[model samples]
Target: MAKGDILKAALSNPNRGPHQTALIRSAIYKEMEQFTATRRLPPSLDASEICRILAPIDRHLTPDDYDRLHKFSDFLAVIDTSPNAHPGYHLLGEKLSADLGL
Candidate 1:
């Protein structure tokens, strides 16, 4: 995604607070793409670095908003590695999905 690109959520609806689903200045979508392309999981992805990258994305993204993303599952895991991201979004998924670097 472009640097100024905005990943908005519930665009047609305004019931949610503006900041809850804001337009963050980031290239995270692209970063996540590369991260996923590596086909790595957990430690391989460098949890600390992942969390650092996710800080901005998570601030503007609410839990419910993420459910709509096409890459929510994996993205959720990566972003949740950050202590700053929203909680309860991090789920320990299947152990043998073949994407765990096993």
Candidate 2:
């Protein structure tokens, strides 16, 4: 699945709010940056490479977690490219998902 697809899934989790999603995404990105810097890896590393690096830090996360993380990363990319990006979109998705018992 694409990255946005995974983010949409993550957003489906009822426990996550807009603020929480934003914080999670920011933390993930920051960690990615630090991982890249420390490993002297290329800035354009692929998703698998990123997953490998993140796995050690988030050992409790299953393979599905990595999949969701990659998706959320993609969603962030789309938001970054948009002119009117807002965290509300993710928040709304989460709220709706919760209401639906998803």
Candidate 3:
């Protein structure tokens, strides 16, 4: 599945509480590491970086997981704030913001 699909699946899973989400994020980081090692790509970027960038926006996330969730939230927020935001993203963001009373 696409990365977006994986993220969505993880987000939508009923069993995915905060702890489970952190675990899933860790797994994704590991996979990214393995993939980078095998592919011998540049040493600059990896999943861990993404995770680090995303953690702050997700209250349930720990410091170690900040980048990942931060990146995810940034993406979501962009989609949420974009003038041409997709209908699905707009709707989802609206619902989420409402639920959080943001």
Q: Which stretches of candidate 2 lie over 4 Å from their true place?
A: 1-59, 82-95
Candidate 2 vs candidate 3, TM-score winner: 3
Model 3 lDDT, full chain set: 0.45
Q: What overall lDDT goes with each candidate model? A: 0.36, 0.45, 0.45
Candidate 3 lDDT, 1-102, residue by residue in tens: 433444544544556356656755664564453341222222443465444433222666544443444344334334424554232333344445655779
Model 3: residues with Cα > 4 Å off, grouped in runs: 30-43, 56-102
Clashes found in each candidate (C-alpha, N, C closer than 3 A) = 0, 1, 13
> Which candidate number maximizes TM-score?
3
TM-score of 1: 0.21
Model 2 C-alpha lDDT per residue in residues 12-95, reported as the tens digit of each score? 555544454544454555544433222223334434444334333433554555465655455444553555443234334544
Candidate 1 differs from the real structure by a C-alpha RMSD in angstroms, to one decimal, of 11.3
Worst 10 residues of 3 by lDDT: 33-42
- In candidate 2, list every pair of residues with a backbone clash: 3-71
Q: Compare candidates 1 and 3 on TM-score and give the better one.
A: 3
